[model samples]
Target chain A: MKKHRTSPTTDSRYKPARPFNADEFGRVRRILGGKVLFVQGDAAVAYGALLAGCRFFAGYPITPATETSEILSQLMPRVGGVCIQMEDEIASVGAIIGASRAGVKSMTATSGPGFSLMQENIGYAAMTETPCVIVDVQRSGPSTGQPTEGAQGDIMQAKWGSHGDYELIALSPSTVQECLDLTIEAFNLSETYGIPVILLTDGIIGHMREKVVLPEFEEIELTWRREPTKPKEEFQPFLVDSTKIPEMAIFGTGYHTYITGLTHSETGYPATDSQVDHHRLVQRLCDKIRDNRDRIVQVERDYSDGDKDTIGIVSYGVTSRSVNSAVKMLRQDGLKIDHLRLVTNWPFPEKEVAELSERANRIVVPELNLGQVYHGVREAVAGRSEVIPLWKTGGEMHVPHDIVELVKGGVK
Target chain B: MIVRFAGFGGQGIVVSSYIIGKSAVLDGKKAIQNQAYGSESRGGECRGDVVIANEEIYELEPTNYDVLVAMTQPAYEAFVPLLKPGGTLILDSDLVVTDKKLEPKKIKKHAIPATDIAFKKFGRKIVANMIILGYMNTLLSPVSESALEKAISESVPKGTEKMNLEAMREGIRLAREGKG
Candidate 1:
């Protein structure tokens, strides 16, 4: 296993993003210094991306996610960064990948309909090992089911939307502050793993306004992808060390780098005819993330007194907020229950869910969709506990009373 | 405290909830504000919700509102029953006539000609929401007056803050004189 670094690390050879004016930076810091900002989750994501050193944004306007691009368009020009309204979602993702290849931290924000259109390029970014961020503010969907309403309907599509077996990282935020904090985390993780990371927020959280206090700029940790150390004459863009992550050589850096969506060899050239080369390339793409699962996966667990079997609630995104409130109501009624909230949903956090199953007699998985993460939890439990799913759709969030009533009724 | 503001889309119904939520946060309380998004075009029925608490608020949308401010009859008829028992209801007397059958009898109800006052005093009917917001805040005291004024000044459109603040003060005077 690779040694985990606690603080963000940037390769010494990598060039840092251009700094904005001192007066402007200080003004932002002062405004956010202990002052509670009542801002929508979409605006919070834009601020987070700006703080994360993301200098380029290319996105088409979509409900629940349009505010992010709108805010970025106003702020990015002030920081001397670029923000463009792409022709469509495909072009938006394509532009970000091109920007990333040029060595700039780039991102795009869109809803489910746009997300579906970007899947091909998302896969292209994964295969080419380009780092970028994609913000999917999920609305009720299955072909524009409800554009403005919130839903967790895209849980499975997020992981398998692209046609591939590549490992991906997706982080879900339940609160407006997390929309800001986790966007930065998504960028850092994307850089660290050389993969496109998804900030999977929903319309409910995306449009809701709440209090947020931004930390001082100096306190924020940021990670930059490792740069190639070898001279231009000797550099192999696809070569890797024991870490299995290749050192990225930015375009126009005098390094002869070749990138393609096709399976390639260590020299960064297509080796489509050889099964061995394909296997080696694909395995490293997947293993680079899987091997670092311990570092990438994060979850929050609540409840003490794990000595006996209790009711366990598993949830993610905005649905987790309902779970939190329900658990409090249940505990007040003298019910023994635990809660596990998934902050990083892509890697699945199977071990944590499995452990919760051991401590609880029955697990309740409440989601905005008809049962997506519930299936994953059931498989992770593997019969150690009974898995019950509370499925809700049509975009209204699960109220605390819904979960409380279900638990009180003792219905499967 | 949970409050809902209901009116036509262009009546600043959502902005009223946002201002109160910001004022609560300024007063050192946690607050969350949300609004019904779609079908909120001008002249369409709209509603905005706000929840203020000293602790972390887990509920995103409250089913029952402690206070409901209705500026139109349709809005009043649609959301009156959602007011909790013994809750307060503030209505625009010029626009909404209450139906006794639809409202909770135990609830406290107050009427003010907010739109008429805004049109007469401020010459802009859009400022009516500010008057209603001030009246509601005075009756409930959900946030400090200083915080509410600051939030109002910051939240209203630039150059219109003075007029909006004046309208709000007029509302405060009305409530003090037992007119609301």
Candidate 2:
């Protein structure tokens, strides 16, 4: 997080004229010159991490997501950061937590099986209030079902795979540009709330290549973890007021910070048996995100101009692209349809979906898996509108023709 | 326009489509490039698709193609049927044996022995994709020649750029001469 740090450049004499890091960031800006870069979604995530001031990355290589780590391994050192290929996904998550504890922005990328292995540590990160980013480029799974194909089966696992009932932030990106933009936002939200943020991308979006313009350096905004203002002797690691987010003291900052996975009080020590302390600790861990949902949750409402005759479609990730194309086709045929694209999948956009239900006669949920997000949408709709599930699996995305046909039939 | 490049994994099918997508963007158009293949690195059936548009491309994956470039027999058989009516089909003549009975009416077909030409001229069959790209661009003009040349120069292996650009020019010459 050092703004004054110098980039390791080949030419020692050539220093950056601008204030930003020159070696990598300046070269990227100069070369691209606001031109579109044709790159895979995975590469965009890696670029997003570097732009967001993430200096530490640790991950086990997996298909679809391996490209993210691969690109970062080459780019991280150029920006004077450490990128480690850990032996396993569990160790990968552990390493990032340690790095974030040391006060450097950290991240890890993985796919389904690897993501499953990181669940315990994810819970630990939440309990320890570590600010780190985990990218899960999803694949067909229950196990290693299909390594190369994309699926949205892990939407539920992202929020509930861990043992505890704690809440976290998860974002879903449908396009390559969003892959870059949302990943940067993931780190910002993680640091802002002191939580482990999950970036839920899929194999399709991760593997696909598209043209995207990298944001100029001046346009980028980074969020760093809040530091304790008190002196080292008087600092309490978990102390907080109305914000419900503690100020983190770096590991070597001479502060007596005791971080543990066990439920702790404001002083950051074990309180394993005290029920009141455990409830208070867990409630704040979940409340910090829940109370800030208005600031956190983002939902894109498309064609809201659709009248009462329009059918409402709710989707996220790669599946949402099909919904977008399908809505266009249906609208062309003089059919009205509204789309709710959930950019923030976890703090499910219940209020917005309920609002959409009130406007439309029926709602459709299209997902890559069989009814993961559909159930959540139904619960949110609360029978205000009929919720229909259009599920497809086996790696291929739902085609726009299929969505059009389904919605067209609903019109009848 | 939606174009598809179909071949085995080692034939540079994916990179060829990527070059077109990049060239289109360089020419100030929007494009998306995507592919489907087995886990194997080589000798497996593969297909890469690119969608280009002046406006935003809502279709992430296309079901049919406006143009098809088939580099192998299986690839031709698997994808040619998906070509839109009145679309164009290009194939490597030495590799794919076309059946007039199965070919759709009102469709233009161009058969170039790209692999043989690559081996004869460039001494490398891997540059066939560049040749097909040149021929396709000459016929369709989806992207400018300068953009295509720049994309190939930036995309190919460092030392191979000169040979790839030469191969592309040969295809362009062939198209101009109406030889393939």
Candidate 3:
């Protein structure tokens, strides 16, 4: 059974024991500015859709993530947007893809089980090179273990969830504030790369409240799924230029285009020839993201001081915050601990990890899931430096002290 | 100045904490509010922590809590170690039966009949969270009495606002009068 954890916000029992300070609260609130809000990660996705020019949302109610669909149900109608709660994850994804094809920015959100269910469709999106956004507010998985708790368990799934050799772009946020910011980034990357970008969130980062300075509407750069400049008879959705980014045209927009799950050419028709347009189309999908990597990846480094000889901790999602906590405390104690917090989880951040691993003898990768991202880190750092994978599951975040102790123990 | 509150899920945890956070933000100080909850909705242990620092606060949880409000025995027992030695622990006398093993010379635990007072005087079980919040003013004079009162008045529902403010004022009165 795929048991899911539902976040309890509307419950009457929700209460806090202490008093609050709004003006003092406003200080940090002003940082992100107008977009600032104390919201869950699911709601953050809904807002990200609004920011990303996404006009449609299709999703089923999945635990630790149902609220994203619920918020969309309420907010979509007001924004001239459409939200459909389909029967299952597969259908949910199908609706979003169809909506995107018919010329609307679209998205869907789910957890591990739903993500697993959507794998075939993800392959379809990848092979077809369709531009869309899929958000997985990751939870404990394999067979629905713990739902409400947070986990970075889906790092591997985000990278290789679909059973094919396709390119994927995933973004992991460390806080609720980043949830909003990164979801927008996911939408941008999805549009820019013409692939389905995943806004990867764990239970903790999705729901935790941090002062988010919301950017005003004007500050956000919005991109539409590209439309063809040529006449309707001469349109090709899969055609690519020097940037390897293809111009996407809607179905009903006077451009008669046919899109399929099979490898297709620039003319929107399937092809089996490996030497011709088939290989070229596939390569474009990979290069549009893999080649223009720097513009697509965002990683935050703390206390690095540009030296890696000191213990370096690499983490993402909620565990990254614990790493930050551990790093901040270690720095306060006059310890040289450099931390790499990966906001962009996909494309694996191969270059930066290699750069950091060279100077530092000790490197720790602490995650909420069991060794998913650890493998990626190990592969990137290779055997030149020590890449330790510390993972915890079943509804608990890795403590900062444990991360610090792990780093210190690496020295011993 | 970070007022970090931790308690189990059903102990009016987020409500009382949000009231304080919302009030603090209105008072013009930079504030950050956060909560931690388990899977279960009602009885799961939870914590609502707020940071009211003068500047930006990168740290999320209040590891060093300034004012700790705990209603259940487990909640108090869990967070007492995180206090900065001299921090205050306010426990509801009704829900929490065991005596807090607090340091008399350093950490002082104030026992208030909060829920009982609400049930008897206010005739509402939910007001217990408010009664203690009202009494908190006595120990915490960092924010002004009027400011906290204004916070209470502005918060809560329209009809209940008056009664909630009264409960908060009574808390202030009790705190001012002391437990003699």
Candidate 4:
């Protein structure tokens, strides 16, 4: 075995760059804008990250998700950003966390197997309250089941994969345009809440090419983590503020903050033994997201008529496209139906789901997986409406005709 | 409009749909293109699907194709049934032989020897897909001529624009004269 250097500067090969200025941001927009580029979903995500001001990327390539890292590797250096292909998925996520803590937006993209490897670090980021993004271009898997086939099997994994109780934000994109737009939203949400945001796409969307009209930089809204306003001596890294979020202190900014995964007090020292400290830290972690759930969750609703007899269909990602088309055809046939598409998957959108269930006589959920989100829909409806699941798991999308047939027959 | 290009792998089937999708976008229409292929690297059946619409596309994949471009006999047999009634069917006359007795009567058929045209006229067999695309351009003008030309130039290899254009024009000429 070769002996490796252990020094901080030598052990880690890439140093995090400073935040991008207006000129650098302008260059990124120019590189991405001006024309409707017919590009793959993975390329759109890479460009979206650059436009969202991500200056650091660390990832280990996996099938279906490799294009994201490949494009970033070529483009990051051109725009004064850094892309590092780490040794493993754990190291890839760890490096991005380190970069985020250094006051730069950072990200990593991977598939199911790589995502499984990154869970420990994902939990670590949550414990440390680091702001970063992770893109999981999902593939069929329990353990590398299919490398190239698309599946929504990771829907539940994305929310509950990491151990311990914590809140997560996940957004699913159906189109290549949404892949770009939602990626930018993922970065913004991560920065706003100081949490790890996951853009849960799948193999089909990752590999498919579509027409994407990117907006000008001036029209796009961007948000960054708020800097600490307190003086160096008064800085408390873990203190909950009026907004229920702690302002972050940059590592090299002379704030002298201690960062660790252990349960800690407001002063940032490890308090692994104290029950009250652990309780406080955990509660803040969950509450920061739960208290602001109204502002964080996004769902698109379309109703044929505001009537209680309609059959409501709930879906997300690529499956939603089939559902939308099915609903349109059913409506043309004089059937009453509607659709509720989940844009933000995590935090569950429990309230919206419950309200829709109350108005809907029956709710149908079609997913690429066996029945992941169906369980959530069943629970949220709570017997107010009959919940049905239309599942397909053979690495194929549900055709609209099949869905139309199901809706016509109604739930058994 | 939903169109499908089907052939064995390595026939540029996927790229043909990609060019159509790119041209649709250039024409200010919403478009999406996706593909399905077998695990084999080459010679396996492959299909590419494109959906172009004046409004936002709700269905990512077409349930029934409005136009079908069949470049191989197997592909032609497999996809011809999925073509909508009265839809246009473009086939490579040299590779796919349609059964007139059993074939649907309502469809409009345009059979062109795309491979022969490419090899005989452009001195390359690989440009057959471009030739087929050029032939389809006449039957269904889903995108403008200029937009299709720009999309072709952007999609093909860096230094082969001139030869590909020649192949495409030859295909257009065959379609204009109703020649197979």
Per-residue error for B109 in candidate 3, Å, reads 2.0
Question: Could you give candidate 4's per-residue lDDT for residues A292-382 as a string of tens digits?
Answer: 7887888888776656788889999989888878987988899878788898899897888897887788888899988899999998999
Given the true complex, what DockQ would model 1 score? 0.89
List of clashing residue pairs for candidate 1: none
Candidate 4 wrong stretches, greater than 4 Å: A1-22, B38-45, B97-107
The weakest ten consecutive residues by lDDT in model 4 chain A span A5-14
lDDT of each: 0.87, 0.87, 0.72, 0.86
Residues A1-412, model 3: lDDT tens digits:
1112111111122121121234423342343234334455666666766655567999998778888898888777766689998999999888888887777778999988899899889888887767788988888877686776667778887878786577978988776767777777776666666788888887666665555556555455555555676787877776666767667777776776888877776777877666676677766667777877776667776645646477778888777766767877787777777677787888888887887788778788888776877787788888768888787888777767777777778431
Clashing pairs in 4: none
Give interface RMSD, per candidate.
Answer: 0.7, 1.2, 3.1, 1.4
CA shift of B67, model 4, Å: 2.8
Over 4 Å off, model 3: A1-36, A273-277, A303-308, A410-412, B1-11, B24-68, B72-86, B100-106, B141-159
DockQ list for all candidates = 0.89, 0.77, 0.30, 0.68
RMSD to the hidden true structure, all candidates: 3.3, 6.1, 8.9, 7.7
- Most TM-score-accurate candidate: 1
The A-chain TM-scores of all the candidates are 0.93, 0.92, 0.88, 0.94
Two-way TM-score contest, 3 vs 4, winner: 4
Better of 3 and 4 by lDDT: 4
